[model samples]
Target: MITPGSNITDRFAIVREDMHRRYGQYFYADTIDALLDEKIAQAKATAKIETFLPVTVEREVSSELEQRAEAAGRSGTARPEILFVCERNAGRSQLASAITHQAVGDRVFVRSVGLNPSGGIDPQVLEVLQERGVPTGHMYQKEIVPRTVHRASVVVLMGVDEVPGIPGDRVVRWDIADPAGQPIEKVREIADDVEAHVKNLLDELGKTNFNAA
Candidate 1:
């Protein structure tokens, strides 16, 4: 039988090796290093490692009040409104929103919503974000609303199910693995994945110039 606290590194190594075997391109050392480097650069520039905010909720009128005022009566502005959504409003969604907000600065407005709202934001998520020096102000778990959906420029889905009634063009599915009730190490791994994806998305947005006004 396996010991409770025995070396699990070997097991992890085996799993990693198996993953490499399954996905050769992603498992290569060079590719992994490049991805890590990109994530590091993104984290350094933004000073956060958690997933950035979703693309949809970031465009809400409440979130972009100042931007809206700036373009009052005009056609529109050029910023993107991003919304991050998950099963619960606590962990992953919060991390993604916080990271995105930090990564894009004030240029993009970011918010997070939940299919089934939780009591409050997860403490562990807050702890991880604080460690990365990302401000936690204005972070809270709230229910998804029609207004939230209508306002988002892009809606990122962290959960499995597609958010009902959201427009097809506005939706972006991330399918991030949930980190609830897991060990800190597992949470960190998930965070790293989120960070990588956020960097990729940022790069895509830069190339596409998909921001709305």
Candidate 2:
């Protein structure tokens, strides 16, 4: 928890510098500052651990900036973006996202979020992914933000029925069990299922080059 007198400014400064370096060509300093401040406030409201608030805010800002750049045809690639959504974002969606990243590398851009994000990731989820040599360093629990949904080329739903405002054509539903509080064995099974689904999705994506419309 960040206290009133904590050095939040220092933490925010780091985010500001990094954002300016990456996105200054597209956004004004003041605009970035305002967006950064809004993200920080939102993070404080929803984040269970404040230790990585700055990093989370930076990610949110970067996502929005990337969307804006793409809209303006400034982003270099027309890569199809995939967003995985689930109830908590700790298990099912996370598994699918990590597996997709492992399978596709940078050929596709993938992200996962929860409807109501809470707690950290399930330990078993991390263990299973690590067992498969999948990278989990960048995986974090985050709530679904509006821009996130709007920017997705494909919104994959796992144990989630629907998300408001997304066009029906962009959504894909998966019937996967939640891995939270499950045993490692069960978690591994879930991981296997997620891996299979990811492989199929990749194949459907034709390895690369997709028309997301």
Candidate 3:
């Protein structure tokens, strides 16, 4: 007797009554039934599905830095800050941080900080970046303060050691090499690693709606 336009709630009520009558004592009338009923109610409440969304802060920052560096080389201006991060702010973190800043011109900011920052910037890291025409300013080590995190709209983490206590929703990790006492070639490999990660991040950010206000 159900019509197409009949209320769903009324139809369900009728069905439940029929089930109870037919099954009698065999019907699930315990806590399991209650749980199933609750789940069903929740599903009915949220029947519509939502679409997936993506954000790429790290990628945009990397791209912006690269472009700025090229333009700055052509002209002669200071770049903006593009913060690079890792565990100790000495090896992988310092290298990635310096390269990113140098590759991007004065229009972009570039800085590197660490979670447990120790040791000065690695000399080998500095050399590779310099070869790529990226400048290495005074590379001191500092802990990642709240102000540092706030200053960066995009943050890149190079290794597990450098992993900060920041929210995962706002951080990007690139598992690169730790060029402590390794050869110069090994440091270059780490630079390549940083470059690849940065490019991927930029591509991802390009596809997102970052201007959502």
Which candidate comes out best when scored by TM-score? 2
TM-score of 3: 0.51
Where is model 1 more than 4 Å wrong at Cα? 1-76, 207-213
Q: Tens-digit lDDT track for model 1 on 2-34?
A: 222333333223333222222232234454334
Better of 2 and 3 by TM-score: 2
Question: Where is model 2 more than 4 Å wrong at Cα?
Answer: 1-77, 167-169, 208-213
In terms of lDDT, the poorest run of 10 residues in model 2 is: 1-10
The TM-score values for the models, in the order shown, are 0.59, 0.62, 0.51
lDDT of 3 by residue, 1-213 (tens): 333344555444443333332222232435234533554465556655211100121223224434644665643422223457777888876766565544442233445677777667778877887787666676678775432343344677776645456533356667677888989998888788777665555445442211100
Model 3, clash count?
A: 20
Which model scores highest in lDDT?
A: 2
> Which stretches of model 3 miss by more than 4 angstroms?
1-83, 106-108, 161-163, 167-169, 207-213
